[model samples]
Target: MTTDHLLYLCFWCFRSIFSVITFSFTSSVFAQQFDQQYLIWKQQQNAHDLRLESTLTHQSAEAVISKKLEPKQALATTGLSTASERVNINQANVQQLQKLKGVGEKKALAIIEYRQQYGSFKHIEQLKQVKGIGESIFLKNQTQLAL
Candidate 1:
């Protein structure tokens, strides 16, 4: 084969190998994350993979790992709850709201104020109506929310 052809073949081989490894790596992380997500998904479980299905095979392992880990860091920082724990927007106190991914004191207060104004949240989806929350934040906590 030509040098360029040989390099191309080798590149494809490595790419395939890396893709396979990604599934393995992400599976291990997912396993660790699973037990935690399980409880939450149980309460908020949807056709959206209550069975613990993962889409990591389509993504770079690094990206998949980072995305999964991002939401839990704040919960970890507080050292008071499991990594998969989610705040109940309807029942959460300021401290609980602050434990969520992007919420700080101001955002937590906004959430409480919103809850009071609206009464109990009609659904987890209603969190999007809060001042600082949007689709992205709501989507990130999909498993953590409850009705």
Candidate 2:
């Protein structure tokens, strides 16, 4: 072969080998990057799963605790007595009136003052005329109110 031809062949072979090496290096870098991204995603997924499990565990514990309580204990925790035992708003004292839902000391006193001024609630709905007793409070205690 001529020297020029041999030199040209050598250059072409070198170029091909160089291209293959560069392609292999770029592919390895891409594979490593993909692996790193996958690991990060996996870690995030595991953390989310742990949070979900913790929430479920807390809910389950609350359910168990509620189930273990006595009926009176449960009622007291909810700030109510037996549903059958209702409050007579017309005659109830401040402490007794406070048994109604949302009726604190101030609200109970307001109810007594209203009753004294207005001569007694003619109807259960008249209890709403008290200063702090709006529709929401009246509705919450509707079932527990007596004439």
Candidate 3:
């Protein structure tokens, strides 16, 4: 072939290779930019979800705390003896009797059952008849007891 024709063919081949390399490089750069944008969006979504979850958890905790602090209205509305008064042997429940000093759940239930089967205690001395009570316990709580 002629020298001029050979040079022309070489120039066309070089131009075609350069064009392919440039196109590939540009596409890769665009793909990388798109991946970075997608990552940023996903991070923002995760942060938003975490914030919503935290708010819900705080609200539930506040609801539980408020319920615990609320007073029991049944005892208040009955217009019976106040909470500070000595527990009535005739009418006191196990829960109420358990508030006394040194009284546990079993002792409180025993006191209630004794009152139910027999009758109201006429005096503090009668409390000794219960299984758990003795002279020392009666003496210690005598001032706090009533008919």
Error of 3 at 119 (Å): 58
In model 3, the worst 10-residue window by lDDT is 71-80
Candidate 2 Cα outliers beyond 4 Å, as residue runs = 1-80
Clashes of each: 0, 0, 0
**Residue 6, candidate 2: C-alpha displacement in angstroms:** 37
In candidate 2 the C-alpha lDDT for residue 12 amounts to: 100
User: Is 1 or 3 the stronger prediction by TM-score?
Assistant: 1
Model 1: per-residue lDDT, tens digit, 1-147? 899999999999999999999999999999989987897777676646533434332333444366664534533543445745766778988887876677789988999899889899988888899999988877877677765
Model 1 residue pairs with clashes: none
Q: Distance from true position, residue 95, model 1, in Å?
A: 0.9
Highest lDDT: which candidate?
A: 2
lDDT of 3 by residue, 68-145 (tens): 532333223322234455766567787767656667889898898888888888877889999998788777666667
Q: Return the TM-score for candidate 1, rounded to 2 decimals.
A: 0.45
Candidate 2 local lDDT, residue 19: 100
Per-residue alpha-carbon lDDT of model 2 for 1-147, expressed as tens digits?
A: 999999999999999999999999999999999999999999999999999877765655565486886655555445447878788888999988988888899999999999888798889999888898999999998998998
